[model samples]
Target chain A: MLFHVLLLITFIIVILIYEWKHYQGRDRYVFVMLFALASIYLLAAIVDWRIPEYVQGVDFLLSPLKKPLQAWLDQFQI
Target chain B: MEQKISSIQFTVLVFMNTLGTAIIFIPTIATRYGRENGWITVIFATLLGMVFILWLTTLIGQEDDTNFFKIMDNRVGKLISYCLILLMVSFIFFTTFANIWSIAQFVSLQILMGTPPQVLALISTFTGLIAVRYGLEVIVRSAEIFFPFTMLSLTLLALLVWPEAQLIRVQPVMQLNQAATFVGVLPVIALTYMELIVMLVVLPHVNDLRQAKKAFLIGGGLAGFCIIIVTFAAIAVLGVDGTVRHAYSIYVLGQNIQIAEFFERIEVLVAFIWFITIFFKVSTCFYFLSIALQHMLKVKNYHSLTVPLGMILLATAMTNLPNIFYDFEMMNSTYLILSYITGLTVATVLSLAMLIRKYKEKVK
Candidate 1:
């Protein structure tokens, strides 16, 4: 977790540095995407703080992939 | 920001990048079919990999300069270039993402079983993005510095286990059947060389055209050697049954190492090395994607693409992969085909076409 946060901070800083040096219209969309990513990280952090320990809403966003993997895991333990 | 890396650095980077992930899986997967004869398939795939490299080199060598995407643009058309770019992006994107996903799963399986693999992935993504943000020069430099140690440590590990490693494990050499060894090595051949596709983005940055083809063969050979040694050791020590049963066989080998019983738990050292090598692998791919994105969208500032590409890669990694086994299966089947067959074939055809074009111009 500490490791991830530091990387994210570094990433955000790199983008800002790049934008400051070469601000242009075409690059704006990229910054927009960065901002959205930052928001997801922030939101995920918030969810970790408020939600029940086992209940993760993010995993559902990837339900299609999770089902089969879970089924494979179940083969061993279930 | 792209400094010209020598043929050695390029070769080392590829070997270090591909060897880490494959060594852990190769023995077990190979044993699933070939038993001891699995090593033979490894040799076969490696030789074939060289053939792929020679062909890829032949293509890149044409015209004194030009990269894959550019060749596609010229040979096919602008629209086709766009399609090729899109395909390349998806290839790098999914493979990079899938690697992250598996690394997380490996962590979860090995330690921190309760923690979501997502957390480990996020850590890797951020580290990878930062590495890519600085550009390929930094990534290549660090990989060069570490590549030798990566191979050395793996060799040292095998040496330590030699005393206890069972010869009978890989014995009767095809007890499992030839299909297993063939299956085991073939997929890895594809995925590792799929990484050669990194050249599509990185080649244009090469200052010397002379070193291009040499780099691929050298790298492929080194990586091939590393894979063979690790897979052979795993079979020799753990045997086919143990190899087949263990998910990350190499790491498991570390767990059993008892150098007078004092040097135990050093598997942490192995894991740390795994972390660094895999990080290098992920960052290299991430950096290339950002570079390619800049070229595709005509973005003036290539740096801006780093975070956005990183985010998409991470998010896609977390979602596009449903679970670990399915991802493994895909790497085994479809994705394998794309990297080895499609990637190698297209590189051969495109380069041949480019060479023919150059010859005609010179003759006229």
Candidate 2:
């Protein structure tokens, strides 16, 4: 876990240096915020947070529709 | 100087986009739903898809040298255009993640066993980042160069597998399930033609509008034909049961090839075609997502965001898709619905908006 975290930080640092050299003002700030959010998300995933479960929740809610849709679609079968 | 791609290059892009991941999954989906009559679903979808392309090109041609986002801004107001743009960006984001996750799953299962999916996802996303960093012309040129080899390999796969194909496997042609066969058209259309809606983001960069439209139809037709041949080959060679059994049916079909028993197990070579096509698809989606972000944030350089966006993509793919079964479930249910809502529905609304604006202009 530490290795992964360090890897993520290193990637962000390299990208930040490149951005700092090439971009300024709003672009750099936006890129920083975006990169930070993405890094947090990756960190969350590495730690086995409930982040993925929320996505699976979508499937759980939509599961009811699948059977009916399948049945309806199966009606087209000769 | 502005970068421009030729119509031929545009056609290759379209071809690559339409084939995308559909090349890997279409045979199984078609045979599963349509049974032995899967090829019929492809043909029907292709015809409908052509009409769709016609409407799309006409809508695009009505404008000058502007992309779909700009067209939306002109026809509709800023508020609605931004909403539409957000929807497109979301669609592109999910699609890109799906592609990355797919390649990761494939590599993990087939080639590099026991490798973590996140690592595989990182590799795929990083490649996409490099491609998007270079911009569209470089991406299109790469596709143009790879198109012939991809096609040649596909043709060879079809021809080499033909001797093993039996007519009896696909026997009761069109007689089994008419309703099911017609319904099967949805997934194929959703995966191939509907997904081509992303091309609207890059259409304005083509050198000639008239030729771009022609290339659009030809590219779509060629992709449809390749899909048909593959579906037929899988069914006739593997039988309907065999085709639907494997997740990557095309790879299994490639494994069936043998030249005097010495030249066998060439599934890796067959898998290479998919790798090339899916890379273009992932890169195109990433590129579209970046452009959409640049327009939305009013950024001076889209290049600056590629690395960050690619990171987000990698993270999202790893988080959302936990396993191959989850990926399959999402593709069949959520992803299918999302493609229709974002892709076809958006295209239809934009076409209507274009017509209304044109009619209002004529009155003025």
Candidate 3:
């Protein structure tokens, strides 16, 4: 957990320093967006969120097709 | 913007990209359904992949120095082009996640038993970041050098395992379970072969667009043939039941290679060759992430985003995938198939619309 926080802080500092050196005007917007995303993800990781369960688009969306495939594979007594 | 790769380099990149972590698990995955005839499923999937590659290369080759997004923008306008870009980005992200996460899992399980998976995932992404920093041409050139060495190791492993390969293990070859075999092809198609769509990003970078058509065909064909050989070796050496029982049957196949009482423990070499393959795979995904984001944002330099994006990939791989079972579930499910087909279909539809518009413009 502490490692995640340290990594996030280091990432933000690095990006900020990079932006300061390069200092392209609108490019800061991209950096800001990136930093925000990294924070959310890193914090989420630290929180031990059920991340995979939410992205269950794979499960919910494709559940219909899954059963048929399971049934087919089960028929072969390997 | 300066396209530097020749036809040969493009071909090698395609071969290396197609040969990703699939090489590690396709034997087990396919054998689970097709039994002794599992290799046949791989061949069928490869053939299907070839058709898609030909269609893809021809679609992009029609316009000079063009890519998938540019073509979409030309035909469908910027609004829909952005939407399609998002879809492609998601597909690429999911792909990179699957490959890197699987590598982390395998390394932690097979070799580095003490290391945390997140650290392994980060380390793998770091290697990819270095390649992405060097740019696409460097990655392609590196593949050109590494491709031969990887292939030689694979070939040596094959020869060493040949004596243990009992033909009797695959005796009931003709009688195949049609439904299971078809189901087996789904993962190979969704996870492995359909990844040739990376060509849509790469084709525009080739020096000769004309050569790209042939390059992709040959590359996809060669890659398919190589995968078939790996699958055949796995089934023959381990038998259908044995192969299906293990998660990574190819690595197990390597463990049986006890030649001259000296050339044992060749799984180390197999792992190294797969490392090269996965490195190229992750590098290609990182390159796609950088360039695609640059194009989407209309930024001057994608290189600036490479490291930051690599950081996201590492985090996502750590957080997004909980275990190897989830990875297997993703592969064996239809979710990836549906997603990949949707992206390919949209790209193809948009491209076809562009071609029609072009023809109509010319006629007018």
Best by TM-score: 2
Better of 1 and 2 by TM-score: 2
Off by over 4 Å in 2: A52-71, A74-78
lDDT of all predictions: 0.67, 0.83, 0.78
How does chain A of candidate 1 score by TM-score against the true chain A? 0.36
Q: Between candidates 2 and 3, which one is better according to lDDT?
A: 2
Candidate 2, what DockQ?
A: 0.50
Listed for each candidate, the true contacts retained, as a fraction, are: 0.17, 0.51, 0.31
Q: What is the interface RMSD of each candidate, in Å?
A: 8.3, 3.1, 3.0
**lDDT tens digits, residue span B1-364, model 2:** 3678999999999999888898889898888788899878888888888887777777676467455577778777888889888877877887898899998999999889999877888899999999999989999999998999999989999998887899999989988877778888887787888888788888888888899999999999999899999999999999989988888999999989888888787888667888899899999999999888988888888887898788778878888887876766666676677677777667777778877877999999
Candidate 1 lDDT, tens digit per residue, B258-313?
88968875566567657767887788778767766777877777677776666666
Candidate 1 residue B260 Cα shift, in angstroms, is 1.8
Model 3 docking category = acceptable
lDDT of 3 by residue, B209-249 (tens): 88878998888788788889999999999999889888888
Rank by TM-score, highest first.
2, 3, 1
Q: Determine which window of 10 residues in candidate 3 chain A has minimal summed lDDT.
A: A50-59
Predicted structure with the largest DockQ when compared to the true one = 2
> Could you estimate the TM-score for every candidate?
0.81, 0.95, 0.93
TM-score of 2: 0.95
